[model samples]
Target: MLLRAALAALRRVEPVIVLEQLGSTFFDTALQMVVRDRCANATDPGRSREDSQQKAMTDFFMTYNLILRLTPILPSLLLARLSDRGWRRAPVVSSLCGYLLSRLGLLLVVVFSLPLQLMLGAAALFGLSGGYSAFWSGVMTLVALRSSAGDRAKAMMRVELLYGLAGLVGSLVSGHLFQLYTASLGHGTILLIVGTLLNLLCLILAIVLLQVKHVSSEEPEEKSLLPPTSSNATAVEASVSTNLVNIVLLFVAAFLYDFAVGGAIGMLGPFTLKAPLSWSPTQVGYGNAAGCMIFLTSYIGVILFRRCISDEAMILIGMLSFASGIYLMAFATTTYIFYIARILNLFALIPLPTIRSLLSQQVQPSSCGTALTLLQLTLKFAGLAYIPAFTKLYQNTLDWFPGFIFLLSSIFTVLGMIPISILGWRSAGGKCHVRTQGGKQPRCHLEEVPAGTSQTGTET
Candidate 1:
């Protein structure tokens, strides 16, 4: 009975997911405060110029991004490989430890007013702990293991919804929390402390309350060393290779889409903190909360449209929504216009989850961790390229047109949509068909519909 109870308790990792995201989001807002404060302090003494602060913040972010991207590649890859080898919780626990330390480091910074560059060390520590790449890759593997392929889409969407909801709650209260002790000696210290506590709690929960064992699928029968062995084995190898190629395509799509979104949002806070739409901290929190709400709206979109449309179509619609909204944001002169543009992004959250689901379906269970980690690696590398370019572009155009960064983001988003469009065209026109069965002689046929039958008569 005790064993059964333990197993049952271990099955519930959702709470851990929720708390982790909540803590991360809360710290995210606090880090924004840190950036603003540190930038003002780093410039000339008693200088509070917006341009100086902006430049300081940009420089800090660029450095932080570099550290985050460069440090995680090897650790995340190693941790993911370990996870696939049955140490399923290794990456998750290590990554949570990273979060704990990073948050704690930030909290200390807030309490002591340390140098802004210290956060770079913190970021490096976090990356060494496998950071977001390993953590999310582990989480995806867990989700995939627990779900059937047919239901994996909904399962992944459920996690994204939870993540968004936690972020929404965190963002809604973060700004207020940041102000609560500002008049006291602590200033934003209380908020960071709370975030640290939350991180510690999540790390504890992850260590004690979660249990997972990843058992890899049996290896294929050993083939002869010589080339061109059995025809059947050759066909199997070719099929596996093709599936991998398709998954790589999915990752590329995700990389481009994430680049567009990340670049736009990275500059958004600094942009809003400046003239024209000079937003207060509360407004910034609300703006972030609005972005979180996109996940909820996209979840609803998945529910309503997924039944009638394919995942690719849903992704296409989401890409278009982001492209349109971001393009309009280039002309958003007022906060109201900005909010309107955000509203137009209701479908913006669909593409990543849908693309992830599609990718998850293409690979075997054993490769889930590696596949997801590589996908994240792609995103990180994209960030490495896009963050500096976008920051420089925004800074250079700060006087005449800061919104040009959003325009560039919209263009990348459009570029992302093209791959999905090609995928959809291929899928719908019966050019690409993946066999669902196993074994070397798996049955295959051209996916088609009879001339006299309805569109859905034989194919989705």
Candidate 2:
């Protein structure tokens, strides 16, 4: 019994999620500090130090994030294909390797006082090995495959809860940890070392012990969610076609929302450092911890919301929450006001996981991983446009209105809701039936009509 319990514990992915988020939190703060310091040191005497520092920081991230997003496309696609083919851990294991390498790369830079430009290469390496695009999709696929379709959203929320708590702990402590350094170890070196070691430990855990075998959520029950429909090939084809359309719509919604959130958020790291809120490292940590708090809140939102509303409704609620909060963020020059804006954004994380859950329900278990990865890659492509565009917008409006980008994020988020609305409308009107015997996708289905029958089963 003791050994069985231990094995069961090892099968849980919570430890992996915790360690990964913890290390990432440490790395995020360390990177921000070092990058800002380097840019500050490099400012030309003729230029405004504040303006130059901000511009260079945004410019650096603009390029670095582009590389991070770009390099992941092909590698992520490849990993997803492998994952669909039964190499279930391919993406997670490969992405974790990238994480370890990238952490070590940053560690080397901080410890040796190496040129900051080297991080660009590190980002590329990270992306080439699948990055978050693959890693997160892989994680979602694991949960999606294991959980029943009905429970996918809650399952995802639990994972996010674990992820959030880890990030909270890491963010709360990372600032102080970054400030800790002996004479031998420079500022941030100790932090980087801890992050790297933790990442290494995660990689080791992923390689040696992480379970790959999972029960596919293809039980007889899910296929029977809808009443018995015709077994006609034409009906099946029609259902598939409708599903394809709905899938495309879901993809658009996800893309728009991510573009809004991603673009604005890419600027936030730099935004906090300017003017009235010139936050110290501790404040930065606190701010990050505040952001992490939403994961917990979003989990609760999903749990309670799921009991009362449909998945599409939950997504819209989350979007509205973010849109309102981010719109308010445009006016926040004070830390207190910023926290309030963040609090308003509590339900923001709900959309994507629910979106993932909805997408999983639209397809068969075998293709679930690929569908999830494709959604992530779609968001990645969105990042390409948003990251640079928002950076430039932030740079151009820095003197006049730095919060302009946040307002734009609000607009995109509102626009994103349209697709989901359309999806919800169509779903309500459409007649859907799941195949009970032959396992097939649920996204597209139609009832068969007799030669003289109307869709209502009446004579024409």
Candidate 3:
């Protein structure tokens, strides 16, 4: 049922997200052109009026993109804040209502005037993205808190699978839909209309889903995994413990790795569209579909190998796979090679969920949302930081520059490998134990612990 709700919500909102991104990009490009034209015409005193008009449009476009990017992060921050509190149904309902209002306002704007349309569209995008991020993050955090330690990994895996599937399907369908609509209606306006409607539907569904008992309230005497907040001193100590050197090192490695991957992933669609090598939108969609298919297969592979391979080992392999795959993608001169790279990239991403699960196990349950949010924030910031660089590099050197970017990215991947080996060694040596002792060694458990560490006599 959770999966079903997730899929339904994703299906309704994914198109809006994709269209908003594309529309923003398009407007930004158009705004640049208008600025250039205005500058060229500004030499004539009679053209001053036109120059001012063009300047306004350019300003609006630039502001729109800036706002759109910033908007999504606010919701993430909100979710992080809320996660520290006990989970409740009220926030979910409030967020859903917010989403609906935003969508409705957007629809009205589209029906009225162009200026209103642009303003409302930007606001709607911000609200929707923020709301969705907060809602999903909270939902996942709640689920993690409710599930048993043994089941948490599986649950997270399922969430990842669903998220990946949604992204895959969403990207393909949205690309095709935009392509089809751009011919008949203006791409921006049509996308806004459709996106608004879909979001409204999502709001309705979310409200209905909130009525479920598990979602409505905390279970009786539920032992929350979150750490106790008994005293300011204890809270300070706990926070300090979370900032350990090893944990900081892990965050750095994770940040760089995610930064590189985020840059490559975000640029892929635009690269496909603008590459000297030709590709239709449909073709690009198919390539994405292929990647998703490979990801699904790799996800299953990870589950099967869980008993045989340690989590650290899996992460090392995933990093290598991601580096190699991206480099291949950057240098691929042929469609088949591009497709191969895409598949490998998808396969490389399979270990992410497992790594996240590993990280959760390392922290107190209450701190999971904060820890994960910090990691996510790093990735978000990295994406923003690298996107302009990627765009500038593309403009200057085109295809050649992507290869260099990938090579730089590969270095980060290699750096990540070092930590995995260190962490894996430490885990194998029983250094970071997390479980209570039993009469015998736990079999088929891939948790992090020190070498020669036997849980048979230890307390959790």
Candidate 4:
């Protein structure tokens, strides 16, 4: 019984999420440190090395992240289609293959002392294998298929919580591992090797252990908002139109919010290594762990908030939290101020996963993977914008105001909130139920209450 239970449990994707995130976190710190080290060593004495190193770091990431974003679109769409067709493991397995190869490439680079430019090739390979777009879409599709719509947001947030926990654990130990070396091996070589090995394990599990859950064949019951007539055709038509509009708006909001986040995140890699907060490897790991803590806090927020309010309201609260915190981040010169900013942004990760859950609800089960992948692809396009635009903006503003990009982020976050607020209004027509059938989580939806009917509950 114990063996069977353990095997059955292997069908869950939690392990894959944990392992991949852990590996990715390790690779991330190692790559950042390696890039900084390379740029520092290559800087000439003629100019300010600090400025030169910063420029080199920014320029490298700009090109690297651009390739990362743009190359995965076509492949990701293809994989998502395969997933929707019942080959749900396509995206997960292929992306895991990409991850393994990329980590291996980095490992080889570190061991052989290869030029940093070679990493761009690895990034291309990773993208061509579907990258994060396909992977996340695949995971979300699997999780969403197994879950009821009422519990979708909470389910997805649980996956993210697992992801963050893995990242925190990996980041906490990554610094010590990076510092460990032997007579033959150098700094960070051990860390890269471990990261690559973890990816390999994830690839094996994605193929051999992961189970795909198929959703119901019955179509979603988009409740009728209009009163009963001879036929429900008008209600169906109105519902379709409404769904189309909501999907588009959700996409817009997600893009804007991602854009806001990308700006601050893009700069943070180089920002921490700058003047007032020149964090060491351990300190960097701790800082990253601090960021990961938000995932836990956000999940808690979802648990508490998803019960009383609509998902849109939760998203708004999250956006406001980020906007306010990132605005404070504009002047985070000291480490304590940075921690304070991070603290204020505790619910920051809530919006995107909740947005994804909303997107999943807008489409049929068969098209869930494609819809989620498109959302991921849309965010990639957002990343494409920030990679060049914010990188250049930050480079230009480095001397005058290093945190100018953060202010832009805050503004974009505020702009992102508009669509969600609109969504909230559109879905607030009548009373909502706190618990659906089987006592699942609340859904952020509404139906028309006729003139004579009395509504008792509040909008979810």
TM-score of each: 0.87, 0.91, 0.67, 0.92
- Full candidate order by TM-score, most accurate first: 4, 2, 1, 3
1-460: candidate 3 lDDT, tens digit per residue: 9998776654443333333333333222222332333333333334344333433433343344345445667676665766566543333444555555554554444345333335536455545455444554555565566555544555666655655565566546644553434444543345445555655655565555433222222322212222323355764564345435346556666767776776566456445544454456456556666655655656775676555666666667778788888888778767888888866765576555655666555566657677666656665566556666654454444424545666666667777677667766645544333443587664553332321122331211
The lDDT, on a scale of 0 to 1, for candidate 3 is 0.53
Q: Is 2 or 4 the stronger prediction by TM-score?
A: 4
Judged by whole-model lDDT over C-alpha atoms, candidate 4 comes out at: 0.85
Q: How do the residues 308-406 of candidate 4 rate in per-residue lDDT, one tens digit apiece? A: 887889999999999998999889999999999999899999999998888876666778889899999999999999889999999888777989999
Candidate 1 lDDT by residue in tens digits, 103-130 = 9888878778787678899999999999
Query: Any runs in candidate 4 off by more than 4 Å, and if so which?
Result: 42-47, 215-232, 430-460
Instruction: Kindly provide the TM-score of model 1 when superposed on the true structure, using C-alpha atoms.
Output: 0.87
Better model by TM-score, 3 or 4? 4
Query: What tens-digit string does per-residue lDDT give for candidate 2 at 1-460?
Result: 9999987777767778999999999999999999988888557455577988999999999999999999999999999999999988899999999999999999999888899899999999999999999999999998877776567789988999999999999999999999998989988999999999999998888888788656654344324123235467775676667667778889999999999999988899999998879999999999999999999999999888886666778899999999999999999999999999999999999999888887877777778789899999999999999998999889888878999999999999999999999887766556444445467545544553211122443321
How far in Å is the alpha carbon of 200 misplaced in model 1?
0.7
The candidate scoring highest on TM-score is 4
Better-scoring candidate (lDDT), 1 or 4: 4
**Candidate 1 minimal-lDDT segment of 10 residues:** 219-228
What TM-score, to 2 decimals, does candidate 2 have?
0.91
